[model samples]
Target: MAKTASDSVSLTRQAYALTDDLMTPNAAVYWIDLLVSAALMWGGFLLAATTSSLAIGLVAGLISVLALYRGLSFIHELTHIRDDEAPGFRVGWNVLVGVPLMTPSLMYEGVHNVHHVKDRFGTALDPEYLPLSRYTPLSLAGFLFVALLAPIGVLIRSAVLTPLSFLVPPLRRFVKQRLSALVINPDFVREDMARVRPAWLFQDIACWLWSWAVIAATVAGWLPLRFVLTGLAIFSLATFVNQARTLVAHHWDNDGGKMSLDEQFLDSVNVPPPNLASELWAPVGLRYHALHHLLPKLPYHNLGKAHARLAQALTPDSLYHRASQKGLFEALTALFRRVAVKPVVAEHGRHAAE
Candidate 1:
């Protein structure tokens, strides 16, 4: 039999107990992963510079793109974990991935917390969500089309707005509330900025300073224009891949309404039997998104173990099973089919009524 709400609660608690040992973040593993990802990114960039061969450069650039994408994904983990738990992880991420990409941790931290709120997961208030299920095919196309230009948007914010905002306090406030956040909802706005956190201000300034430094170096011929352009291209392509991955991360079915824990889990997605592709696209614990939603406080490193525990504890008919798909392609196809068939089903029902 399918588990009731109470049963789900009991099972969730049990699953949490089973995975308790894995909840703590491992500093050594975290540092090693970050360093390796950095090496792949910069190594590829240097290789691109040394080679005049377009094919070789392209291959190397793609490697950097994948590495940068995975590196940026660590920001998701940063948002969920506490400062004390992973003391220098955030700083390391900011130096390596955040500032260079112009996606500071401040852009995600508080904004992502709202996404996990039980009442806000699928609503307009959820910064990370959009009602993609109701979108027409053309609208969906436009969504992805806009995402392709996200790197340009980030550049404009960092290169143009960041410096200007410092001189103009009002503009700084505007940028802080509107431009600073990394959110998907078009209508969502962050209003709180009266007393900015010291860490956020420092990260913002660091990004601003780095952005100007890069610009100066490139203009002065200290940094090769070719290398700068190559880096920008890699960033753009990586962000595009991230956007594509985001599209299939959820069912995107909920309207502007509150969802229970079960409904929320069902509305989310998980790509099970995690493989190379899943890890590359949804790296650093993203493949277990549904499970993360179930236990938001659980560390990213522990998500896979928690997933296994839950799979063992829950039956096939559980809501958890319904939320998971075999792979990214399958999930995207399911989303597309859901949108495609809705109109046909409605039309058939109208004919039947007539």
Candidate 2:
């Protein structure tokens, strides 16, 4: 008899629990990720300056940029603090840790969870839905264009659409506190915008103030504006790479067919935890994606263990092959061409590489 979905989850969870049910992380690992990322960021900036070359600085900036995402993912896991926890503690932790990384605590918490739901749960209605149609082949030029332009796209998506979404009355009740008071209410402003969460409000203010501080310091000769811009560019590029990576991971071979949440997670490939490459361009939790989707609340350290646990239960042939390190450029080339095509087969939802 074939096992059902519930049986699968139960078995997987049992295996997961057997390894280490301890959900929360050790204090040392937490601080180490934090300190190491920070030190590398500042160190990268210093290295950029000492080299007196924007190219070197650009490389340094990329390292720090990856570090930022790793830090953000860590904070993301932390933001999963249970509702029973003191609201003040949750909010405070989000603001202090999240503000520095420019992660919108309130927004990420909501959207990320939504992003995890099964693709078939909603139609185009799903925010995190990966439309199977995106698998169409693209010219090599178009693929490269998409990959290269990724960072700019992320900035526009996050800095604009995200803040504007607060206009919705229901969403505003949760996100409005993060909006600027001076923001002109659109003609059809919802009345509920008045109730802002103090923590989100303060954090938004802090982010703006921090950006201003950087701009000011750059202008005042405390930090080179070019280096700062390079950092921002690299940060933006990292985000774009993350999106491109996801495109390859999720949409490939998705032929307008339904896939279960667990199936989808199984199909989405994780980039191996990077070494030299990791220092320069962070993987954006790509290494732990399967773990992330499986248990959204677990901090990243547990991701490897989760991946290992799930390894046993997973159908061997189901594992998605990721682009290898040496073939990174080649993978990008093939990915841009949408080489991961699903055959027009007899099965309703199964995918196979062509």
Please provide TM-scores, in order, for all candidate models, with all chains considered together: 0.92, 0.64
**TM-score, cand. 2 vs. native:** 0.64
Query: How high is the lDDT of residue 233 in model 2?
Result: 62
lDDT of 2: 0.49
Report the Cα RMSD per candidate: 4.6, 7.8
Number of the top-ranking candidate, with lDDT as the measure: 1
lDDT of each residue in 95-138, candidate 1, tens digit only: 99898888999898888888998777787677888767777776
lDDT of 2 by residue, 1-354 (tens): 443466547644654574467466555566666667667766775676567777886677767666655555554554454644333444544454455445556545444454456753222223343333333344323443454454343334345544555466654443444332211111112233365657656666665556556657888999877676666665556555555444444434454356665456555545544333532333434555555555666656666665566565555543322212322343456554554463332322223221
Please report the TM-score between candidate 1 and the true structure. Answer: 0.92
* Model 1 backbone overlap count: 0
Candidate number of the best TM-score: 1
What 10-residue stretch in candidate 1 is worst by lDDT? 345-354
> Which parts of model 1 have CA positions greater than 4 angstroms off?
1-4, 343-354
